[model samples]
Target: MTISSPSSPQEYIKHHLHSLQFGEGFWAFNLDSLFFSILLGVIFLSIFHRVAHKATTGVPGKLQCAVEMIIEFVDKTVKDMFSGQNKLIAPLALTIFVWVFLMNLMDLLPIDFLPYISQQLGLPYLRVVPTADVSITMSMAIGVFLLIIIYTFKYKGVKGFIKDYTLHPFNHWAFAPINLLLETVSLLSKPISLGLRLFGNMYAGELIFILIAALIPWWSQWVLSLPWAIFHILIITLQAFIFMVLTIVYLSMASETEDH
Candidate 1:
């Protein structure tokens, strides 16, 4: 996690973008992203666990009320979008929303705050927003992709799943190969596009924050950064909601039967 002081703005941007890494190539790991992602996940689970444990029927505390509202909102969204009767959808949506929102929320922090703290503690490369890292977002997207596969197979069966790609959209043996090609690309693009979308948006947002900090004098940064930060709150929340809604929609489509 050690980094040399940057001599130029390009070097500064490059340094800030670099991850605390280990290993090489495909085996390399971004330890900072992993650390903060897991940390935020644990925080989300711990708070929800505590709130649920003490939840009361009447006069709920502010924390409990907020948690309930979030749960209800996610539940309603699941009911609206997810037609299948899988109990996992609601919880999965809630987890994705909260976990991703928490990760994106890190971008609102002063770009250098955590990294500076880490540097003082003898670690220099620390990127706090896990969503800004493609690997993290892709991992999550792949998880959803796997769930889509599982649900498709669970509801449609192996033969049906194969036929899904190989048969219709043309419904003839002549078009099976063509159908498979189009369907496979379409299915595969779900995870690829999902992962890249979040990564692109958050990465851009993080870079802008870094740019403001690097280019502006500390005394005047508030003039521009404040407005951007306020607007960014909407971006972060919208990204989280989009991710959650898409996950639900994909799973719903996967869980559909021929009867539907």
Candidate 2:
């Protein structure tokens, strides 16, 4: 759908960028991000739930077969990357891949579709792509970070965890201070990188779509958008896969026995 005549391209971009937020400053919340994230999650799970219940051995439906394939792919990915045999990792990988994929898939929707519908419904702004929001991306990264911490303690105990941080790569007593700083930064950068990587890719992709819609004539918008959307399909899927793989790798590092 075409957005009728914004006063300028900047105004058009600003309108699309504005989120449905409430409260003040640090306490503010993005209602549209939360709504779409939860909505997409529910939709993803509901479809999977139906597939699970309706699965059959004889001539499975397309949806059921596709889900089974995804389950198998995720299971294989987890088994390959996750060193320890935790049943949770497979399901977690599956959930993360599918959910994040669906979330990123939101970028495929027409740029103005949700916002236009929401405008008519009294909400001023709506960004359909949840991953474009830093908070959502960081929260997912933090959740994985928590799992990494938990598995580290579960496998290595508190003392071993501390020792892993303090003693490695600098065994000399005089080097302990330097080791701690380096280790602390190293440990912290994982989640930071994960969050920023996904956020940057998605935010840029969404912005490009908005810019296309804003700068191009309504009649000519499809010429740019269609190609970008086609390319973005690969990007959306890659980001999800990368997130899943990194989570598996990080958790594997946490749960595995340290090299002597």
Which of the numbered candidates is closest to the native, going by highest TM-score? 1
In model 1, the runs with Cα more than 4 Å from the true position are 1-3
> What value of lDDT does candidate 1 attain over all alpha carbons?
0.92
Can you write out model 1's per-residue Cα lDDT over 1-260, one digit (the tens) per residue? 34567767788898899888889999989999999999999999999999999999999999999999999999999999988698899999999999999999999999888888988787868888999999999999999999999999999999889988898678888999999999899899999988999999999999998898888887999998899999999999999999999999999988888732
TM-score of each: 0.97, 0.95
| Among all candidates shown, the one with the greatest lDDT | 1
In model 1, the Cα lDDT at residue 209 comes to: 88
lDDT string, candidate 2, 1-260, tens digits: 33344579998898888778887797889989999999999999999999999889899999998999999999989888887889789988888899999999999999888888887877777888999999999999999999988998999999878777888778766787887888889889999999899999999999999999888899999999999999999999999999999989999998987756
* lDDT at 87, model 2: 78
Cα distance off (Å), candidate 1, residue 3? 4.5
